[model samples]
Target: MTQPDRDPGLQPERTRLAWRRTTLSATVAAILAAKTALHGGASAAGLVACAACCVLWLGFLLVAHRRIRDLAVPGRPTALAPRWATGAVLCTVAIALCAAALVV
Candidate 1:
């Protein structure tokens, strides 16, 4: 059996997978950090941090899905650059949560 010719232009699929993996890792990190902070006696702060992290993760998930869909279909009239703001937000939240966890 002969394999079909792979379209090299669809290379964004690799990036899509990477985005998914990052989202998953961030989620796990958030859960662990929130749990630790709560256990360390920063109940209120920890809960808030956890909620914020959850929201951020959801945002990332939605963006990742949209990006993957966009990548799947090429040649659209308007080309959009990936939103770096989302990534910056994720990093900021993660850092804040980590600090909150440590202080707790």
Candidate 2:
């Protein structure tokens, strides 16, 4: 009886790249939201929504950056914690909602 060797392959690299892409998307969304808020009449509520978008972007960035860093380390990376995952999801959804608020 013999155990098969595990093939790490490029999965980790792919995951890291995916996270980078997501981070980029979040950055773009935040930037667009700010631009809209500034040029689209700058209402008090719009400004507040823009600020919230920035905060949510930063939060998501922190979560993504930590995951990317973990993926870069050799050996098996630890599973993402439930809290971090939840935070990332919430931040993303909230960012979209805030952006939509600015638009409407």
Candidate 3:
């Protein structure tokens, strides 16, 4: 028997799911870091950093959601190019998480 062909949008759907997972991970990590910071020596600074990380994650979530919505279109896009803000904030969040861990 012949194998069934995959849907054209299957890749995009998987990509969208991956983005959602990334956003979720960022949110959880931010919350944990915030909690760690709150109990650290500098409560004020830790809380402030936590708030900033949450805000940045929120921004990336919104941008990723919007970009994924356009993934279903039949345009002839060659490669995946994430928006600058999304990529920058995602990297920033990773670095901030490390810094928060050290400080906490």
The best candidate by TM-score is 2
Tens-digit per-residue lDDT, 1-104, candidate 1:
53344445545666667767877876787677667657757667677766766666676677666767776664431244646545646665765656565665
Clashing pairs in 2: none
Task: Assess every candidate by TM-score.
Answer: 0.63, 0.82, 0.65
Candidate lDDT (C-alpha), each? 0.64, 0.84, 0.65
| Residue-level lDDT for 57 in candidate 3 | 67
Clashes of each: 0, 0, 0
What are the per-residue Cα lDDT tens digits for candidate 2 across 1-104?
Answer: 53333334767788889999989998998898889878857779878887888888999999998999998887676787899889999998897788777667
CA deviation > 4 Å runs, candidate 1: 1-6, 40-42, 74-104
Per-residue lDDT, model 2, residue 18, is 92
Predicted candidate 1, C-alpha RMSD: 4.0
Best candidate, lDDT: 2
Candidate numbers, best lDDT first, in rank order:
2, 3, 1
Q: Could you give the C-alpha RMSD of every candidate to the true structure, in order shown? A: 4.0, 4.1, 4.7
